[model samples]
Target: MKRKSNIKVIRIPIPTPTLLPHTTTNSYLIGNEEESILVDAGYDTEDTRKLLEWEINKHGLARPKRIVLTHAHQDHAPGVRMLIHWMPTILCHEKEEEQVLSAISPWEEITLIEDEDSIKVDGEEIIVMHTPGHTLGHVSLYIPSEQILIVGDNIVAEGTTWIGAPDGDMKDYLQTLQRLRNLKIEKIGPGHGKWVHQPHEHIDFVIQRRLHREQQLLTLLEKHQQITSKELTEIIYQDRIHPSVFPVAQKTIEAHLDKLLKEDLIQYDESKSSYVSPHF
Candidate 1:
């Protein structure tokens, strides 16, 4: 890809954060001189594609070379079929291949990628960073030239990202946050909510919040001796989030407990079916 001129990053906001108060997911149209790439086509309907297409046309952008996904979550990869109709290649981390395939089946034209891989749009290069933990294959794209990072679900601007177990891991999520914080990012385009103008500040806020929450959980456990994850969720997140979101919040709290367990600060008692602090 040759840089005919300075590259442009266009935010194509699609309202899709149904569970949260967020109004939209920031789908980006990135391009430079000759080619463009669409990041996270998650709208899940033809209307999404139409909106994207209209944006492309409205800006006079070149047809995208490919549609790249940050992860396999429904809100990030749903418009795959519609984007494929335009003959653009679908790209995602190889680790998320199965999850993406499951969403849009019988479509095998995806270009699987790995961490540290570089994607070229026109003449510019977008480096891929495997920032998992939100999901097994979550990735973020970094443009060295512009110092802009397209952080998928690894971090969000509006509300904190949910790190549920089985798929999401608090340990990995925290590690990923630390790794990204070291990056030279000027602007952050997240999968949800608006763009983050102060990249490092926003990342610091997210990391501190999670750590603070974990500390709160630890204090609660120290006093209770042993408690079920649900019990901890109630104590720590009660009234902070809606009741309907408690189930997911419990899963996140469990991730924190699991991380603590891994650190030998806590232990899960099989007989009690609860987690106990190290003091116990």
Candidate 2:
């Protein structure tokens, strides 16, 4: 792919069930020529492809090379089969190989890209970094020349990202943010939410927010020594929080509990959703 010298980003909005409008996932069409690579595919529905096709035709794209995912979120990983049905490969974070292999993904074929991985598209090289926390295999894509970081769910531009249990980690997520701070990023192309104008500053803010949430989790567990995940989630999510986002938050708290349990900070008895803190 050759640089057209008139390249720009074309965004396709996918709004699912959420507090945010038109922002479940954003499929970014980035190119320096008529051929472009898609960042993330929308939900697993015909509408996603139709919307993308409309955008592709509208932009006069001559070719679709590859489709990329920030992580294997249901909303973000869909339509890869549709994409690979036409394109060469659907690139994913190498950490996501299991997600892809598990057929948990709606796609058939996917190539993994890990941290320190790079790909050439439209005369530009995109670097991949394993920014896990949202998911063990979640990745952040970076364009060195552009100073842009196409982060998946590690850090949403606006609200905080979920560090749900089973995979998400508060410690890793904070470290990922710190890792990004070391990079000279100018624009943050997030998987969801608005574009981040102040790159590193926004990342710092996100890190602070995650740490605060971790503290809140610690306090919540200390206050309620014995509570079911459902009950804890409800208590954690106040009236102001959207119900749609609670499930994810619940998973995040569960993830923290699992971690704390491993560190002997907390003990859990699955028969009861209660968690006991050693420090308490």
Candidate 3:
């Protein structure tokens, strides 16, 4: 689909065996007649490969010269294996090299990118923004001409993006959200769901929701004295989340705990195998 600017963006929802509620990952074909860039290939499957090829052929988009991955998640980057025939130059943040390589083949050459790197597609500049949080190397592409931002997994159309431990960080995620809110964005093409029109408002909602959850965790920590992340998740989410999502919720709770611990607001009790307020 053509946006307000000269660039064309076609959102192809590729089916993937991802987490609950997210049945497909949105891979975008963005560019003009001169060149095209495919953002985020879905999981490695014949179905995914066929769908992507169909979309490209239907749109008559030129063979994408490059494949820019937002992160190295299974649902996002593994499909690069299917596109090896295109010999497209793979691009991703330096921090994501290890994971990206693991997802694809180790022998595949990857070009590392940093913040502010500009990719010219048919004369239009697409600025890369390293919006780490959901993952250490997550990036969002910005089109200054169209005031559009294509966020990989930073912001979704429905609910909230998971900020779990290890790969995900609550502190970094909050900072990323604040940074995105300051951008001159009119539309957002997220990794999942439909396009977001109220960019700032959507960003603000995510920010506020995270902050509220953080505050709730603090309050619970104070009330419970020493509580495990799993226990905290049970209290915070209760029966709202499915049994299958319990582990994900617990990981997110652990991320919040890690943030609070770093801030010296909470302390982990080794003996109790739980977290507690610093004063406790």
Itemize residue pairs with steric clashes in candidate 3.
none
Give the Cα-based TM-score of candidate 2 against the true structure. 0.85
What TM-score number comes out for model 1? 0.94
By TM-score rank, best first, the candidates go 3, 1, 2
Per-residue CA lDDT of candidate 3, range 83-189, in tens?
Answer: 88888889999999999999988438789999999998988889999999999999999988888899999988888888886799999999999999999888999
lDDT of 2: 0.72
Ten-residue segment with the worst summed lDDT in candidate 2?
15-24
Q: Which candidate's lDDT is highest? A: 3
RMSD of each: 2.4, 3.4, 2.0
Candidate 2 differs from the real structure by a C-alpha RMSD in angstroms, to one decimal, of 3.4
Superposed by TM-score, candidate 1 places the C-alpha of residue 109 at a distance from the truth, in angstroms, of 0.9
Off by over 4 Å in 1: 1-5
Ranking by lDDT: 3, 1, 2
For model 1, the run of ten residues with the poorest summed lDDT:
1-10
Listed in order, each prediction's TM-score against the native is 0.94, 0.85, 0.96
Clashes of 1: 4
Which of 1 and 3 is the better model by TM-score?
3
